[model samples]
Target chain A: AQSVTQLDSQVPVFEEAPVELRCNYSSSVSVYLFWYVQYPNQGLQLLLKYLSGSTLVKGINGFEAEFNKSQTSFHLRKPSVHISDTAEYFCAVSDFLCGGTASKLTFGTGTRLQVTL
Target chain B: SAVISQKPSRDICQRGTSLTIQCQVDSQVTMMFWYRQQPGQSLTLIATANQGSEATYESGFVIDKFPISRPNLTFSTLTVSNMSPEDSSIYLCSASGPGGYTFGSGTRLTVV
Candidate 1:
C-alpha cells in the first residue's frame, strides 16, 4: 500500500515570487509520483509525474518537482508564480509493483496555493 | 492520452433521490476509476470500475450506496444512491493512459 502526505494545507505567495509545495509519501514497494492542479470548480489537471530515470521532473506551466528517495519526498516548485497559478495542488502515489500495475492512486489532503498580486 | 467527457456537469438532488454520472473516454483505457472530493477535502477513491464485471470498492464505500457499471472499456457510470446532504460533493472519473491519467470536468453534486 502507498500513502501520500501534503503537510501544508495552504500556501500564500505573491505574484512572480518563488514557491514550493511539500509532499511526502510512504510505500513498501516502488511507486510513481504525480502532481495535479485543480482550479476552482474544475477537475484535476496533470501537472507532472515521476515514473523513473530522472529525479527532477518538469511539467507544464513552469512547474517542476524533485523526487528524493532518502527523504521520501516529491516537492513541487516554481521559480516564478503567477496570479493564475492560484489553485489546489495534490500529490498522489500509485504502486507500480514489480512489472506494472495501472493501479489506484492515493492522494494527499491537498495544498491550496493562493498566488496574489 | 485519453480524453474523457463526463456528465452531468452539476446536479441538485433531494434527500433519498439518486443521480447517475457518466464518463465517456475518447480511447480505450486499461483502467477506470471513480473519485469523490468532499467539501474542503481531497479526492477519495470510490471504486475501480471493471469492464464486464463488478466494481472493486474501497473502504468506507459500498456497492449499495454507489452503484457502478462499466459496460465497455470506454464507457462507465457511477450512481449515487439514496442521496443526502452529506453526499454533496464533486465526483470525478479518470482513465489511465501511456504516461499518466486524465480526468473529466467532474460533476458537482449538490444534495439538498
Candidate 2:
C-alpha cells in the first residue's frame, strides 16, 4: 500500500514569484512518484513522474520536482508563476515492484495554488 | 497516449435516481479504473474494471452501490445506484499504457 501527503493545503503567491509545493509518501515497497495538475472544470493532467534514474524531474509549464529518497519527499517547484498557473496540484505514488504493474495511483489531498498579480 | 472520452460531462439528478457513466478509450487497454473526488478532497479509487471479469472494488465501495461493466477492451461503464447527497462528486475514468496514465474529463454528479 502507498500513500501520499501534501504538506500545504493552499499557497498564495504573486505573479513572477517562486513557489514550492511539498509532498511526502509512505510505502513499504519501491514506488513511482508523479505530479498532476487539475484546472478549473477540467480533469487531471500529468506533470511529471519519477520512475527511475533521475532525482530531478522537469515537467511542463516550467515546473520541476526533486525526488528525495532519504526524506521520502517529492516537492514541486517553479521559478516563476503566472496567474494562469493557478490550479490544484496533486502528488501520487504507485507501487513499482517487479512485474507488479498495478497502475492504481495513491494521491495526496491536493494543494491549491493561487497566483496574484 | 490513450484518449479517454467520458459521457455526461455533468448532471443534476434527483435523489433516489440512478446514473450510469460511460468511458471510451481510443486504444485497447487491459485495465480501466474508476475514481471519485468529493468536494475539496483527494481522489479515491472506486474499482478496477477488467475485460471479461468482474470489477474489483476497493474497500468502503461495493457492487450494490456502484456497478461496473467492461464488455470489451476499449469501453467500460460505471452505474451509480441509489443516488444521495453523499453521491454528489466528480467521477473519473483512467487507463494506463506505455505512454502513461490518462484520465477523462470527469462527470460532475449533483444529487439533489
Candidate 3:
C-alpha cells in the first residue's frame, strides 16, 4: 500500500519569493514520486518525477523537487516563484518501478500555492 | 504520455439521474483509472479499468453505482448511477505511457 502526506493545505507567497511544498509518502517498497500542477479550471499537468537517478529533479515552470529517502519525503521547491505559478499542486506516488508501464497512483491532498504580487 | 479527452465537461442533473463520462486516450494504454474530486477536496480513486476485464473498484465504490467499461485500450466510460447531491463532484480519467500519467480535462457534475 502507498499513501502520501502534504502538510500544508495552502501556502501564500509574494512574487519572486522562494517557496516549498512538502510531500511525504509511505510504502513498503521503493516507489516513483511525481509532482503535478493544475491551473485553475484545468486538468493536471506533470511538473516532474523521480524514478531512479538523482535525488534532486527539476521540472517545468521553474519548479524542482528533492527526494529524500531517509525522510520519506519529496518536497517541491522553487527558488523564485511567479504569479503564473499560482495553482493547485499535488504530490503522488506509484508502486510501479517499471520505466515504460503504468501503475495506480496514490495522491496527497493537494496544496494550493497562492502567489501574489 | 497519452492524452485523455473526457466529455460532458459540465452537467447539471436531477436527483436519481445518471451520468456517463467518456474518455478517449490518444494512445493505447493497458490500464485506465477514474478519480473523483469533491468540491474543496482532493481526488480519490474510484476504480481501475482494464481491457477485457471487469473494473476493479476502490473500497467505498461499487459497480452498482459506478459502472466502468474499457471497450478497448484507447477508450473507457464511467457511469454514475442514481446520483444524489453527494455524488456531485469532478470526474477525471487517466492513462500512462513512457512519459508518465496524463489526465483528462475532467467532468464537473452537479446533482440537484
Candidate 4:
C-alpha cells in the first residue's frame, strides 16, 4: 500500500513570487509520482509525473517537480507563480505491483495555492 | 494522454432518485476509473471500470449503490442508485494512456 502526505494545506504567495508545495509518500515498493492541479469546479489536470529516468521533471505551465528517492518526496516547484496558477494541487502515488492494471492512485490531502497580485 | 469527456456536467436530483454519469475517451484506454470528490475533500476511488467484466469497487463502495458498466474500451457509465443528500458530490472519470492518466471535467451531482 502507498500513502501520500502533502505538508501544507494552504499556501499564499504574491504574484511573480516563487512557490514550492511539499509532498511525501510511504511505499514498500517502487512507485510512480504525479502532481495534478484542479481549478475551482473543474476536473484535475496533470501538472507533471515522475515515472523514471529524470529526478527533476518539467511540466506544462512552467511548473516542475523533483523526485527524491531517499526522502520519499516529490515536491512541486515554480520559479514564479501567476494568479492563474492558484488552484488546489494534489500529490499522488501509484504502486507498480498491479502490472499497472490496477493503476489506482492514492492522493494526498490537497494544498490550495492562492496567488495574490 | 487521452481526452476524456463526462456527461451532465452538473445535475440536481431529488433524494432516492438515481443518476447515471457517462465517461468517454477519445482513444482506447487500458484502464478507466471512477472517483468521487466530496465538498472540499480529496478524490476517493469509487471503482475500476474494467471492460467486459464487473467493476472492482473500493473498500467503502459497493456494487449495488454504485453500479458501473464498461461495454467497450472508450465508454463507461456509473449509476448512483437510491441516492441521498450524502451522495451529492463531484464524480470524475479518468483514463490511462501512453503518457499518463487524463481526467474528465467531472459531473457535479447535487441531491435535494
Top of the candidates by lDDT: 1
DockQ for every model comes to: 0.57, 0.52, 0.61, 0.51
- Considering just the first chain, candidate 4 attains a TM-score of 0.95
| Candidate 1 off by > 4 Å | A97-101
What are the per-residue Cα lDDT tens digits for candidate 2 across B1-112?
7899999999999999999999999988888899999988889999989899999999999999999999998999999999999999999999877645789999999999
Q: On residues B1-112, what C-alpha lDDT tens digit does candidate 3 reach at each position? A: 6778999899999999999999999888888999999887888999999999999999999999999999999999999999999998999998877666889999999999
Instruction: Write one digit per residue (lDDT tens) for candidate 4, span A21-85.
Output: 99999998888889999998778988999888979999999999999999999999999999999
Which CAPRI category fits model 2?
A: medium
**Tens-place lDDT digits, model 1, residues A60-90:** 9999999999999999999999999999999
Q: Compared with the true structure, what per-residue lDDT tens digits does model 2 show for residues A1-117? A: 789999899999999999999999998988789999999878899999888888999999999999999999999999999999999999999875223135688899999999999
Chain A TM-score (model 1): 0.95
Backbone collision tally, model 1:
0
Per-residue lDDT tens digits for candidate 4, residues B1-112, read: 6798899899999999999999989988868999999999999999988898899999999999999999999999999999999998999998876566779999999999
Ten residues in a row with the worst lDDT in model 4 chain B? B94-103
Best by DockQ: 3
Candidate 2 reference-contact recovery: 0.44
- Candidate 2 chain A: worst 10 consecutive residues by lDDT? A94-103
Shift of residue A114 alpha carbon in model 3, Å? 1.1
TM-score of each: 0.97, 0.96, 0.97, 0.96
Better of 2 and 4 by DockQ: 2
